[model samples]
Target: MAERDEQSGAAPGALPRRAIALLRRLARRLRPRSVRARATLGASAVVALALGVASFGLLGLLENNLTRNAQADAERQAVLTAGLAAEGRLDTVLTPDRGIDFLQVVDAHGRVLAASPNLRGRPALSAARPSEPGTVRGTWNGRPVREEHRQRVVQVTVATGSGLVTVYAGTSLREADAADEFIRASLIFAVPLLVLTVALVTWRVTGWALRPVEAIRAEVAEISDRDLHRRVPVPGSQDEIARLAATMNTTLDRLEASVIRQRQFIADASHELRSPITVLRTQLEVAQAHPDPDLWGELVNGALEDTVRLQDLASDLLLLARLDTAQTPPSAAVDLTEVVREVARARKGDRVAVDTEIAPGVTVRGSALWLARIVTNLLDNAQRHADRSVLLALRVDEAHGTAVLEVRDDGPGIPPADRERVFERFTRLDDARSRDQGGSGLGLAIARDIATHLGGSLTVQDSERGAHLVARLPLDAT
Candidate 1:
């Protein structure tokens, strides 16, 4: 069975499947690569198909009309001849009229009594003795005069004085056939020319329309990371290609902004990290050069503090990097009230008093650790700036469907102009605060970033006597 199957070349339907696959591959290879060429080819194919069908239809209609006319002429000629024979005025060699090719008269005994000049001395063209006048196909013998050709023959019977007789008339189809051939030849020559003209026009139009896209592509290809500030040219026309150029320019603008921001971030991070590292290194170097036991402890303490600051800055930088890239939303529900109370309680016994007025059961959906960090950062900022005390408050804004956390301090309030700038990384108000205060300047920035990641916002609002910072997070509906 295996041998027999192999001898048959392939399993049932497998050959057809292989052939179809080969054809598809060939089609793909033959397909034009450029959009303009493909458009031209597609348009040409459709037009050619339409023209071919119209030509065939035209030919069929023309052939049908010509055939009907020929049949009618033959019938009319037969009727006229039959009338003449009935009046006993028939001639042996009759003169054909009205495009009729031949005419014949026969008696009931199957004898040719009279005929047209072309059919003289010839036998009956057809033996059909139709009761009513009707047309049929026959051939003209043309024995002694004209050439043979296909004809439409119409026979009519009439009761004449010499018993019964039949009249035959016919018309040659040579003229109609010649008309059909001419039309067919003309169409065969014209269709391809028309299709070629259409293809050429389509190719030119398609290329013109795509010129803007090509310009955009070239501009983009010339642009690089160092030259992201450069923009693609926008066409004046309000078309899709114009819109595409505009969109490309917009994307370039965003890319350039992102690159600038990244560079600025790196510069700032390096500056921030350098401060603690420089201090620690200098302290170590001075202690090493002096080698004094008395000042060793003091030097070590200062070095440890610088090291701690370095550690904190590194951690803050890492957290910011994660927040920038993190896309997953916080899934766990956390009690905002508890987080605030916990942070405030931990901050007790500090130089500035920490106070809290948290509403119970104020819950939100976010990472609890990050939520605690928000409170911790806000409280730390407040403590560093407060004159005497820091107030932390958590409340549910039912109407807005949010949990609002506000931290306020009784210190010189932040100026309205610097409020937004304060949230930027490594920013510290020189008149109001200093680096000597042991604040990394990233605390508030990190707090704001966490709030944004959790689908919330943190901002400094108007306050009576001190800077008032507010954080709002959506409440956990579940």
Candidate 2:
């Protein structure tokens, strides 16, 4: 295999890389996907680690404290025995104190001079000798003594008739070790139980907190374009989840309004188109039935008129669709004064007398074609409804940073209540302003849409004797 690998020119670490990749893939697959489960597992791992560290530290402190106390007891016992030996009043057999486990006395020659009751004939418990200060303390494993395990031993030396004698006093570590074992066993049992409890609590709490989110998801999933009126359930907690629900409802409201507007627009467009088509079809059928050359000319003219109206309606619909999408930005700086004057000039010979109050050097940022279209539509609307005279005025409102264009006509003025309603597509007031007056009813709507697209506004304002229309566009600073 090695030879084959070498012949194949494989890298030395390829196998290890593949193994690591496989392990990562397995880990990803095994990882918990639910947020609640992940939170529970994360919290458990942290708490477990903290408890483990604290347990080890506690055990260490316990062992140190126990060893210190034991050593202190042993030192005190050894000192008392050394004092007895120095006075030459030592007993051959000594009784141990409540804390001390064993006591023994030896001379400079290592001869055992005294022993405790439990170690009557036992040899010296430790070979430790005192320093120049005549005292020493240390641990000793009780070897050759079948009963004792470990002890804290302290030796003290004294000068007497026998020259130098050493007293060895020791305390067994059985109680401290037993205490440590008991606590270790408790922690060993308790840590896992605590971690499990924490995991269960965390899982339940996280699930409870996310219940609102689940409800929202379910409600949203059931909602379709047709049912945009439905809203997500908002929790009463007034938390981030509640705010999210409110925001979702707001979005749904806007979506519902947009769907309604689109439906209305389609219906209106269909009705408008059907009128011209129906009229044209009727005229053609009449021409086909009569087959009279003299009447054919008038029929063809009427058919042509209906065809023109249909064409105009189609063009208006297409323009409105483009404006609705609003895919492009107005990048050109057009002179509002020029556009107004040019459109007013084209309507010089109209039935209604047209008058212009033009202002020069009034510039705005927008497409010239749309700007002209706004002016043309406003003029057309004014001329169609005007009794005798239509007034067009242009001026720069430097105080408001806008260019204002006003078109007023001496005609039946719009009612205050129906002022805004006039901007609706395919809307016509009573018989006086019906579709028979060569008006598509989209003139005002298209004008308003164009003004809006150019970051401007078009609206019907109060007039004393006739309709007053005003348009405002942002003035170009440059």
Per lDDT, the best of the predicted structures is 2
Using Cα atoms with residue i matched to residue i, what is each candidate's TM-score against the true structure? Answer: 0.79, 0.75
- Whole-model lDDT for model 1 versus the true structure? 0.86
Global lDDT of each model?
0.86, 0.88
The prediction achieving the highest TM-score against the true structure is 1
**Which residues of candidate 1, in runs, are more than 4 Å off?**
1-29, 68-121, 124-176
Give per-residue lDDT, candidate 2, residue 69: 96
Candidate 2: residue 128 lDDT (0-100): 53
Show the lowest summed lDDT stretch of 10 residues, model 1.
Answer: 136-145
For candidate 1, the per-residue lDDT at 326 reads 69
lDDT by residue for model 2 (338-357), tens? 88888888887889989989
Per-residue CA lDDT of candidate 1, range 110-167, in tens?
7999998777888765565555433344444443225455566777888887677888
Candidate 2 accuracy as lDDT: 0.88
